[model samples]
Target: MLALLLAALQAAAPSPGPAPSPQSPSQIAAEAPAAEWVDITPNDLLVMELAPAATGRPRRIVIQLVPPPFSAPWVANIRTLARARWWDGTSVNRVQDNYVAQWGDATEAKPLPDGLLTGTEAGYTTQLDQQDSVVAGHVEHTLTPPITALRRADGGLEVDPYARGGVGFVGGFPVGNEGYGSPDTWPLHCYGAVGVGRNLSPDTGYGAELYAVIGHAPRHLDRNIAVVGRVIEGIEHLSSLPRGTGALGFYERPEERVAIRSIRLGSDLPAADRPRLQYLAEGGATMTRFIAARQNREPPFFIRPAGGADICNVPVPVRAAP
Candidate 1:
């Protein structure tokens, strides 16, 4: 009877399958089906034209505005400013090393167009769709299970130093929440992120003055400032500019500032001039593969996989629309 039982147990054991092949993040993204890519609406695109580089190459930066339900008032003001051509003739006034590249009226005297609304400090964070319950004065987020691609293989949320709820892509932008199940979610300050320049509290920026993070990801600035958009293309134009000599990276001399030719919404541009772009959808199968590959480095250049990746390190893949 013992011999029979042993034979049965051995038969019941499952056969082993082949080990999965390793793939790099870019490889996974390239292999993704076209259907996994989502088109960016022209109306939501902000195109800024800077003066040509010394090499005479045209310099154009494409910015994708955060979708509605986040920074609504500031977004509205940005649209208004663009329609009125308010940023024309303005200059990039600051280029702080390992920080940001700022622009607007360096004179700080540009008259904002009419109908531009002032954003309040409260607008900095958007309430989460998921509700929170208070337990002993501590808020507990009741997160729904595994909604994003940025989850561990066993369905655990990725860890983030800046967000207790952890970080994930929201509308193709990296965002953090209070907890995995927390009630508040806000956009992040990853490199190439664009935000409004404000003086101090109670004075949220009106979107007239803007800055693009050209250095390290300033996670500390996450919920403190209004992150209006991000540089989807031509970021090198801003990142490679000379560092500012004045305080806070502001140019000390007027001649040092880089001039802005124009800033316009893609919808306002002619069909021939408008740019069409797309990003991998956050919950798509391709995005899941991409995230996994990013967390685990493969064997071409690396001998050992890192096992984990920073939220900012896993940038969503954005490319020209096919």
Candidate 2:
């Protein structure tokens, strides 16, 4: 009887499978080596404070500016605006459902600070320094030096629905280009991307009016708008806002606007107040694993790994500095 009881207990116990792997993307990122992390300087951070929520919770959004070699003029203008306190007392006037949340001087009467750069429509894309040469029976190309590492598979190329050539991470941002060796590269409109609002085609925005993508990845807007930065923290403050009723999601009533308390560069804040953040280095082993994990979800939850992923789906991992 004791042996029978022991056998029943053993039968009821679940069998262990291969030690469960890092089943999620977050787990992969958590296991990344410390050396594979990259720090975000305070100067590159744009800190925007919104009026507290109904619950009285302070809402602060931290935006990390796109580094050099892309959107230079707009980024510079944003820095200047932050330093000049240009966005103080502004308001988010638009909250398009599955689109964007825009903020600026709603009155449209506030004067922009001096030294704002007038970026051209051409500034929408950065032309990489491309030099093609054949090396060892392979078409080798030397492109611009990358600021943010990129994941290059099969000679730096990946399938993309928007970009005929391909899509990949460049300078830590998702960029679509003609091909692996294409000279023209433009930032993508992924969720949380911060972009300059402009008039018609002729007027590239000078960084005064800004919007954050709060919905799906609007790939169609790529190369048509200037993506200067991405919201690294507190995106929920913008994404969870009430949608606008007016045309194009602009708030019809003035009372509908969400007020902006202040916008400042992180560098201007006191050391303790400054946000210290970091991103997992792209092209690093850990990032590769993270992307793979995202593409192919493992056991416990997902039944079948998709075996593929959208470029936007594999966003780089950012975290508060340890």
Candidate 3:
């Protein structure tokens, strides 16, 4: 009876399976079906043309604005600025090493152009004044609460391997969570993230001056500043610029700054002039596969896969629209 039981137990044991085939993030993305891709609309696109300086190559940077419920005030302000051509004459004034590359009217003397709608600077106003404005026939921009973190089955919040807090995505933007099911959600300060510059006051930034994270992800700034959008294309143009010499990476001389030729809303451009871009749908099957592949690298080059991935480490792939 003992011998028979041993034989049955051995038979019940599963056989070792073949190792998972090595798959890179690019390979996984390429294999994704067409339905897994999302097209970017013209209304959400910002096309920025930079004049060529010593580099001899003109730079064109494309930014995709976030949808409503997050940073609505700042997004509206940026659109207003673009329509007024407020950034046309502005320059890339700051490039801090291992930090951000900022561009705008560095002198801080440019007047708010005419035809801008009200409530754009509501962030800088007193709470009582803001309430009064809303009550007194002023149209208020509605901001949606974002889903920033996720709760686990055990009633604890999930934490990524990098320990940067629980992270997720909303409308394709990476978001960090305060806690599982928390009402507050803020965009992550990942690479290529575009943020508004402000003074000491939290609401002082009016989208006139903007900066892009060109170095390591600064998660601390996630909720402190308004993250309007991200650089979808030509990030190299901004990231490769020379580091500024002045305090906080401001250019020491006016000539050191790169001039902005123009910034136009993609919707305003002709069909042929509009930028074509598509991104992998977040939380979809394709994205899941890509994330898994990145987490556990099976390639021979990697002797041991980390078996995990950071929020910033997993870059959402983007490509020209077909």
| Candidate 3 segments exceeding 4 Å error | 1-21, 53-55, 114-165
lDDT of each: 0.83, 0.82, 0.74
Off by over 4 Å in 1: 1-21, 130-149
Write one digit per residue (lDDT tens) for candidate 3, span 1-322: 9999999999999987898777789998998888777777787888999997475877899998865556777889899999888998889999999999999997889997765433333332112111121110111222223332233334444465333446666566776654443444566789999999887753447788899999999877766678888999999999999999999999999999999999999988889999977878765788877877766777678898776666777777888888
**Backbone Cα, N, C clashes tallied per candidate:** 3, 2, 1
lDDT of 2 at 82: 90
Return the TM-score for each candidate structure.
0.87, 0.87, 0.80
Of 2 and 3, the candidate ahead on lDDT is 2
Per-residue lDDT of model 1, residues 52-145, tens digit only: 9889999999998886567889999999999999999999999999999999998877788899887788788877664421111111223343
Of models 1 and 2, which has the larger lDDT?
Answer: 1
RMSD of 1: 7.6
Error of 2 at 136 (Å): 32
Q: Residue 66 in model 3: shift from native, Å?
A: 1.4
Q: Flag regions of model 2 displaced more than 4 Å.
A: 1-18, 130-156
